[model samples]
Target: MGFRDRWVDWGNGSGFYNLRVDDVSIQVFRNGFALIILPRYENIESSDLLSHVFRDLYKAISYLYNIGIVVDLDSIKQVNQEYAFNHGYLDDVLRGRPKKARVELDRDARGLFNKLDQKAKAWIDRSYGDLEIETNDLEYARRLLLMPEIIYNLDKKLAPILEELSNQIRLHLEVEERTLSTLEKLSRYIEELRDLQRRPSLFKRILNWFRRWFG
Candidate 1:
């Protein structure tokens, strides 16, 4: 049986299904939501496997209404290395116990799941156009598979340029602030000099009094 069939069978019987593929684990609950635990791996095999799993899982879950999939990318890297090493497989890591897959929201959790399901379906519809593509379209599948590599390469090339631009902006802001501070100090000094000049000097006052007495 296919993975989805097996998962459905188990879920129907137990109200929950848990499966492990490579370094990742997938848990689906009766509420029609799933949690995907993705691990950090530098190897190409792991990356390819992750993408495949994501596509397949999305395909399998797309038929069901009111389902949401939450992907936890950060938590997997925080897993204890020693524990992971001991466990070897994801099923072993869970110790044969299925993790709780239910999400708790205030008062309207089912509504939230339904919203998520609708959004996911909308995205899929936009991407694949009514999901009418032939299942045996190898060329289409090949292009889809290349998407991850394309994104990775683009990100790798763009990161340094983005960092450089950010640094330049920060430096410009610092210079602009210093310039403003200097202008403020200069303005205060000019204002003080103008105030001193406006006051009548002692010599000028004496000269004016002499002129007045002579007249």
Candidate 2:
């Protein structure tokens, strides 16, 4: 039977689900939402096996969702860029807005993985029979097998949510500034009208109209 160890914490409001199938380990992070991290799989040499692993991962995720788990797929993007490529691009991707910035970053992330896979395969092809091959190239091949840490559809699906939130924040701030300016202008106008009443001069009214029209 497959082994599973899952826990949900109340106080810290963060939880994780871990499932083990043979040598693979799948871990899920749950807080405001859910993000599942696919376990490391060995043998990246076969592209067919790698594709199968991705299919199996989606199947597992579907099962979890069918059972009522709200999972965030974007979490995978972080792992793919940060752990897999060992590149410094994760920070820019995660910290940036999900609409345009995140989309752009994830494209870069995918490119990185593709490049690594190509490099690993090329290395394998070149060193297939060579006895002088170094350990570094072999390690890269192993990494290719270790399921890319990033999830699919993360940026595309969530970009709208991110864009909405950002727009709301910006709209609220802008409205507030406009309201403040209007109120200040109204207050000053009331004071001028009060002065006009006290002075009772036609010239003051004409001056006020001129100021309103020009200023």
Candidate 3:
């Protein structure tokens, strides 16, 4: 289901939201803080979906920085496997006698678990490898999840910062343009003065002045 359809209110404008990107499920909980879950799944598209989700998360983080809300990476974990399922599937194997169907089901469950485990590890690496953040830290994870809402409330200050930067760049460019124009005019004037010094009329005027004085 869509995120809006699954949004559940917890109270005080805090609640649960399931944000889906393509086929991936990213669960977000809002309780004066945010909690994000990257679901574990066994599918061919799972890796790509996870990568896309990380990119989206980074975009959100960058937006926060642009708005003067710097996220503390120390408060975020690189890997969190608490949501990863346990080996309850092994219990099914012991429940039935040595039948062909039971063997197939057991094998399938094992394979599914392996795939999910591998995917979860890879997602953790890709998400938090360079950040150097520890995984499974409860407090850090809490701050990381609540980042979106924290930045949202600080949104009012963003426009002024952006406008100030834009104005500074514009002023610099205008000054550079004016400086170039002034240099071009100065160079042209110098060239004209040099040409006048080389002209026959100027020499003639000097000759005439000498003749008038010596005649």
Candidate 4:
């Protein structure tokens, strides 16, 4: 089944509030506060999807920030129970599980900034000419890296990356079975080294004794 979605009311002339990234809905208010809600899905893996959602959210935030809007970090910083899936595979994950998932508040904002900086560097390649046209500012990228909403939104974007990383690992393991077998053979050879018989040559034995003593 697919994801079940919802959105808060967008009043008339309220300075554009609705932002949807895939199945997640980010409702922005005129006052800069925003709420991110996720759709409920059944029996679905969330690890990857969540990553992509958050990453794209960061992109969206970059878009918003460039327009000179102050991002409310406090409003969208934390992940609440409201964002979790309400039904389908997601519901099953919480069926016998706890009502809420543990969210970590401690984070490295500096690292996030570094990432934003990298993206901005790439963005310049595609926007260098446009950047010179006066509507260009990199401060938004800086704000996005520093804002809590960006981080919160980032969690959604990262889900897909995580899934892709997982799939890559799985593929590597599957395709490297022959390499694993070769390593196993090497391990066996090492294990047999201790059982190797001593040579009977007096010269070789004397050399071995010398090596053991000082070489």
Question: Best candidate, TM-score-wise?
Answer: 3
- Write model 1 residue lDDT over 88-205, tens digit each, in one string: 2344444534332222222311121122221111011112222211212222334455879989999999999999999999999999999999999999999976775677595467
Off by over 4 Å in 2: 1-5, 8-14, 19-24, 70-78, 81-215
Q: Kindly list the per-residue Cα lDDT of model 2 for residues 1-215, writing each as its tens digit.
A: 12233554546665566654444455655434444445534334444645865776677667666656545675434224121223234435445433211111121223222432222221111122221212223344354445344233566678899999999999999999999999999999999877777776765777788999997
Task: Compute each candidate's TM-score over C-alphas.
Answer: 0.31, 0.29, 0.33, 0.26
Cα error of candidate 1 at position 54, Å: 28
Q: In candidate 3, how many Å is residue 174 off?
A: 1.7
Question: Candidate 3, overall lDDT?
Answer: 0.49
Candidate 3: segments with Cα more than 4 A from true spot? 1-134, 151-156, 203-215
lDDT of each: 0.47, 0.49, 0.49, 0.49
Per-prediction backbone clash count: 0, 4, 2, 23
Model 1: colliding residue pairs: none
Q: In candidate 3, what are the lDDT values of residues 168-194, reduced to their tens digit?
A: 999999999999999999999999767
State which candidate, 1 or 4, has the greater lDDT: 4
Query: What is candidate 4's lDDT per residue for 149-192, written digit by digit as tens?
Result: 88888989999999999999999998799799999999998776
lDDT ranking of the models: 3, 4, 2, 1
